[model samples]
Target: MGKNRDGGGKDDEIIRASDDLLTSLSKDPSIMQSIYALLPNQEKLQGARDRHRSLFHQVVDGAHDKEAELEAARNDLIAQMSLVNGMANLTGKHDPTIPQKLGLVHQTAGKRPSAAGLSVPENFRMAYDGRSIIVRGSAVKGARSYEIWVCESDPLTEASWRHHATSGKINRIEITGLTPGRLYYFRIRAVGASDTGPWSNFISMMAI
Candidate 1:
């Protein structure tokens, strides 16, 4: 037996001492073959673990991309719906009169007892010449007369509306004494003996 440099037994000495009791079994080559066979299985297990880790990361990344795409699609759908609703509201059955033109009146016989239907032409125009507004629109059917209301603020709000002009069975009316560079709202309504109709839709004009 040889002594180790570190004052321990050498490798060969240690092996030989352990083999003395099993000298016959130590010579069996089948035992050494069994130990070597387990190494390939260990390598396979390590490869499987690495592949599983890579697949997990791929799934996480895919989920994040899908979430982002869904969010973008939802926003696009909302914008499209809003545009459709706005167009529908503009072309609906409601009247399109300016605020300054609104008044109380009746149109039809039976309907005259109720509310008078209000209307305003699509091509109606308003122009301000220094001090007065020239409002032009076609006459509404069954309207005996029209009343025009003008106000600096919204006419629907109380204390903001003021009478600007009134017309007798005519389609055109000119409003005077209005300030230049100011915004004006107008509407028109029809009148009957018993009651006055609902005010027409409001239209706005910016005085030049």
Candidate 2:
């Protein structure tokens, strides 16, 4: 009876170990689903996934190539536009189609004469005041004040000499923030209540 009981005890231990392994595998849903699906159609699923992945990559590569071709075409169009603009300027005929910009260097604009006998500002003179140049001139009849213009380089064209400063109804004005010993060109115009006057002769002076 003792020998029979010992053999039965070993058999019970072996059966308990097998039950524990089965319980662990049953707790994992992913492992159970994988095993069930593979048993039915594993080969068909793998082949379909491989074919779809290859098609997806081919579509992505074609899109990238198309984008590169479009970028190259856009660059070519911009270069052609620049060339056309250059040709127009060479023929001394500015394209009216081009929009005007403030920062762009424009062609000289025609000036209409002021009401009769309105000449340039008279007695226009300058004297150094510390780091500034003092421009002084009296206004003639029909004149209100003056507009002053200055540039390091002479802007000979009327459009380039856009008035830099406007003075009060006084004869004297000071230009501050000048570089000492630097030569500056200045021009002035008599301004009436209604309209601007013709520009005066260019006056070149060195800042003291």
Candidate 3:
């Protein structure tokens, strides 16, 4: 009735505009009576808009909740997939034929015979980068992993050495977040399926 303004906008915008229109119509009973007898009254239209507006808001909130649930489910599945693939890779390393049967690419390297006992890593060296140290050592045969140990105090004190990181790579391990000018002692040990080797001779490096 108020200049026949545009309709069919957003739910909240339309609802507010309808409320103002209803208030204007209530003040003028003459205009209300002039409405065709078959047409809905001002009160009925306002009630319908309010009901639908409430339902619209509920549906919007439900959609957001459902989206969050979907994201969490997807992340969980991704983590499980990573775990399964890592297991498959380890299995393939031991048995090269298994990867082909499982439809996974097998990395073919010269297969070294399994050692009776794990051997200690040797030739320990450290390079001083501007912000970090790159530690290297000779690879041990049949080694599955390398454990890096670091000592901030006296290297002679066995209790001072603490486990730093375990690397899948044999050499060129980068250690970061070191305090500048601090002297760090690092050592390495080879880990095999059946045995853990003794620690290598410690190497020292000063953080820049």
Candidate 4:
């Protein structure tokens, strides 16, 4: 398992807020370059203002320990550096992608996730919305990911089920592409590294 500095699968509201912020930060070209600059794996680029590794570590550690304060500081620094360019950070109490991006993990990408520790998803429901139906699910313990399978007809046979969507760490997903007011059957499963757990008890809903 990789050191999930991005908070692993823990779902804290504040952590999610921080993650959303960091994901936004990663988009700015200058800010992204700053991250790449400090990445241990990256070769120093010409003309890049390479920050001191000690200072970088300090910032990273501060993110984990002082997230609330870090949020304010991160915002202020971004505003201050609006013109200077190449300012970036991946520190946070919640940002899970940081460890992977910063070369801090040995995570194996594309490996099947395991579902041994999780039970079937619970509280599965469908939300009515104009022209779409949202599939909501509750997280299962010991699972890091989820797969939502949906069928337009009764799922009495394998051929009726279709893979719909997958989520990373979260339990809820929004689904579209169905005829409005059609009866749809849905089920979900916990995904593991090498196998998938049993499907949740199927639920049927009329799409709005």
lDDT against the true structure, per candidate, is 0.50, 0.55, 0.60, 0.53
Candidate 4: stretches off by over 4 Å: 1-115, 129-131
Give the TM-score of each candidate: 0.38, 0.41, 0.43, 0.41
Could you tell which candidate, 1 or 4, scores higher by TM-score? 4
Root-mean-square deviation of every model: 40.5, 37.1, 30.5, 19.2
Please report how far candidate 1 places residue 101 from its true position, in Å. 23
Distance (Å) between predicted and true CA of 10, model 1? Answer: 99
**TM-score head-to-head 1 vs 3, winner:** 3
Show model 3 residue runs off by greater than 4 Å.
Answer: 1-116
Tens digits of per-residue lDDT for model 2, 1-208: 1223312224444456668758878888687778565332335535444544554565567755455545544444333333333323223224433322311223222233467545566666676433356788756567777788876532443453545677875456877776874555677777777877777655556565
Point out where model 2 deviates above 4 Å: 1-113
Q: Model 2: which ten-residue window has the lowest total lDDT?
A: 101-110
lDDT of 4 by residue, 144-208 (tens): 67888887542545686899888875444777677763556677777766667667655556554
Against the hidden true structure, what lDDT does model 4 obtain? 0.53
For 1-208, candidate 1 gives per-residue lDDT tens digits of 5554533335675576557637755778676678466333435545544554555465567756455545554444433333223223233326433211333121222222234453443234455432346666556555566677876643445476777666775445777776764556676666545445555545566454
Which has the greatest TM-score? 3
Instruction: Extract clashing residue pairs from model 3.
Output: none
Cα-based lDDT at residue 71, candidate 3: 52
Best of the two (3, 4) by TM-score:
3
Rank list by lDDT: 3, 2, 4, 1
